[model samples]
Target: MKYTEEHEWIREEDGLYVVGITEHASEQLGDVVFVELPEEGSEVVKDEDICVIESVKAASDILAPLDGEIVEVNSAIVDDPGKINEDPLGDAWFFKLKVTDLSPMDDYMDEAAYKKFIG
Candidate 1:
């Protein structure tokens, strides 16, 4: 898993990556009420805004952490935004990206670094 300073996380699986917010982000957002997901097969660039999450506290954008085609979206989250708070690292994953360049991941924080950064 890799983490972004923006509080996003990406986990690799079978050459694709599942993307979601970290638990700290979920908690900071208060209660999530809505989620807007990008289209499957849409091309996205690193750091581009791709999804929107609205919470009781404020609305936030979920940025594309890498350049890639969005291969899949977790509709379950759109239907139930609270899932992001309940399982941010698991079933609440927002999208799957087949990244064009993985080098950006090398610049992202590892678990230990991310913990220290959040601390």
Candidate 2:
């Protein structure tokens, strides 16, 4: 998995990339209460606000980790926000992206670097 300083994670699988918030991000947000996901087929640019996550403390934007067309969204999170805090790296995933440009990943951090960045 690769991550952004903003707490987005990206993993490529069969050409498309799966994106979500890291466990560290969910922890910071406390208990998640709402999730706003982008529509399928919507185009997103790197660093753009693709979704919004509302927690007990604050509402944070979920940034796109790469330029791509949204292929799918995890509606389960929208329906049950607690999944985000309970299984951030598993059932809490946000979206799947059909990537357009792959270069931005070169600037992303690996797990070790992301852990340091979050620290």
Off by over 4 Å in 1: none
Model 2 per-residue lDDT tens digits across residues 44-99: 99888889999999999988888889999999999999999999998888999999
User: Which candidate has the highest lDDT of all?
Assistant: 1
Give one digit per residue, the lDDT tens place, for model 1 in 67-92: 99999999999999999999999999
Q: In model 2, where do residues sit more than 4 Å from their true spots? A: none
Estimate the lDDT of model 1. Answer: 0.95
The Cα error of candidate 2 at residue 51, in Å, is 0.4
Clashing pairs in model 1, backbone N/Cα/C closer than 3 A? none
115 in model 1: Cα distance from truth in Å? 0.6
* TM-score of each predicted structure versus truth: 0.98, 0.96
